[model samples]
Target chain A: MNLYDIATKLDASILTPKLDLSRQVHCAYGADLLSDVLAFTRPSTLLLTGLINIQVVRTAEMAELGGIVVVRGKPVHRSLQELACACKIPLLRTRMTMFESCGRLYQSGIKPCIKDPGCECNVCPSV
Target chain B: MSAPLCKKEFFVQEFDFEHAGKAASDMRKLLMDYGFDQQIVRRLAIAAYEAEMNMVIHGFGGTLIMEINFEYIELVAKDNGPGISDLKLAMQEGFSTASDEIREIGFGAGMGLPNIKRCVNFLGIETKPGQGTVVTMRVDLGPDAI
Candidate 1:
């Protein structure tokens, strides 16, 4: 689904609405550590995490992630927003904790990136 | 897909998480504009960003040098001091010695080297504690090139 749909489902606020919120996301990868995210994330997926730094945006850009969802009411830096704008990806914020947001997205048919869905990996919120 | 096209260098500073991925993003943008495949550019960017982070988090900051050719993309990162004591251990996933300050920013998971290795076809690292580290990563375009 698109960012607008995902944001509505998770009670998230879109930070970059002009970023073509119409981009579809097949799955979501939730991780605070970028290494795990890089290893496990699928292209065109969304990145869910509590980290709100420039590197996280960089990781999303590298992984070609569809967008970013910052959980737990974290404040996003201006540089981060600029990076997202330059990268042409949407960034969203939610008062929802990482686990809760992932659970919400997962229940909405947005499974993890594992090829065989439900393959038991911790990267995607299976809780 | 086999000719040297362009080169650029990005300077990174220790504890400078604010601008960690600038080089990678710029490089990826240039490659994408040059018509490289998304996958290739992404792979190159991942490795490049990881190496640059290592430089900032572990050493006295350094330069991320990117050399792009038709056949491959090469990333060379050279830092000035406080090199890794053991590369073998550093290469292991989840092995990290990042300070608490670095970890506070959510980056010290010890996956830097491993992640870099994962994205590149060839990886080389040389370092000595108290001196510095130099890393070289290469992603081959493979046998099929348009």
Candidate 2:
């Protein structure tokens, strides 16, 4: 699914719609730990995280992920929004908790990182 | 290695989460602008970002230097923060000295150094208690690099 679809499905708020949301999200990753996200995430995977910070944007860019969905109804700071705007990484906000968002996306047909085909345990569920 | 095509430096201030990843992002832009291998460039960017954040979250403040050439890219991150007390312990995954504030900012899970080591080809560490620490990392441009 594309970012728009995910947003609609989750009823998320688009914090930085100016950033590109054209790219398709093949997989989904949900984690609060930036370290785990950076370590395990693959390019084009949509990050569903509760942790919102500038590093989240930096991590998305470095990991080559599609975008970030900040869960838990947390208010995204302007700095975070600005960074996403500058970097052109799409940012979404959702009232749904982390687990709920991940489950919704996973059931929507998004998979885990396709880089490792052998493991289909849905660990992070990337495409 | 041949003279670096370009060398750039960035200052990272302790507890400066606001501008933490600027230098690393700059390095990414530089590498991409040079048309280096995409995967290699991503790895370098990750290393750079992790190193840059480490200095900001753990140290008082520091500088990041990027030296780039066709053969490789080297990143040096030096900080005036408390040096690692145990190199071996610090290198282990999930080991962290980050304060609660840092963690609240979405870092300090004890993965910064280890993550950098994972992404780079070479890693070095120099430190003294209460003095400072320096981390040197290198990522080789593969044979396919133009």
**CAPRI tier of model 2:** medium
Q: How well is each residue in B33-138 modelled by candidate 2, as lDDT tens digits?
A: 8888877877888888888888887778899999987677889999998888999999999898888887887788988888888788899999999989999999
Interface RMSD of 2: 3.8
List model 2 lDDT by residue over A1-127, tens digit each: 7889999989999998777677898888788888877777877879998887788998998888899999999988898898888888899999999888988888899886555756542222243
DockQ for every model comes to 0.53, 0.52
lDDT (Cα, 0-100) at A82 in candidate 1: 85
After superposition, candidate 1 runs with Cα above 4 Å error: A116-127, B1-3, B143-146
Q: How displaced is residue A32 in candidate 2, in Å?
A: 1.0
Best by DockQ: 1
- CAPRI-style grade of the A/B interface in model 1: medium
- After best superposition, candidate 1 residue B22: deviation in angstroms? 0.7
